[model samples]
Target: MTDGKVKARLKWACRRGMLELDVLFIPFVNEAYDDLSEQDKLTFERLLTCQDPELFAWFMGHEACEDTELNAMVQFILGRVKV
Candidate 1:
């Protein structure tokens, strides 16, 4: 299969994961990251698919975005909400 095909599949899977992110996450976004019960946020971060500015924003309150963007997001969120 072509690179485009692989990328498309990845995007689709990421979208599906986004649904999970919303279901499992949205409620905790506005809360201070440090205030969260550590394990819950760690679990969400581990399971989340679209990890990106969108997710970070969603955590802070923004749009949901792509699959691989998660690593940067993990960093951003941790950095932004550090203790």
Candidate 2:
């Protein structure tokens, strides 16, 4: 329920999705993301946990700030993404 917690979760979630997300889209999404309410971020984070369909939903702009689990599997992905 805290923004800091959500941000931490989201940072992890972001790395997990690895997503093949467009680097170009980062600034745009980050800006829009900054303007979003925290609840929106949590929701989007949830949606992020799924496979391509849910990921595509965010990419396609159908979902914003969906809630997705940021677990050990995600952390593993985050580790790979870090390098």
Cα-based lDDT for every prediction: 0.46, 0.48
Error of 2 at 13 (Å): 0.5
Q: What is the C-alpha RMSD of each candidate to the true structure, in Å?
A: 13.2, 10.8
Task: lDDT for model 1, please.
Answer: 0.46
lDDT per residue as tens, model 1, 1-83: 67466334434434434453443344334444336455644544454544444564655544443434444454455564454
Least accurate 10 contiguous residues by lDDT in model 1: 24-33
Error of 1 at 39 (Å): 27
Where does the lowest 10-residue lDDT sum fall in candidate 2?
69-78
- How displaced is residue 49 in candidate 2, in Å? 1.8
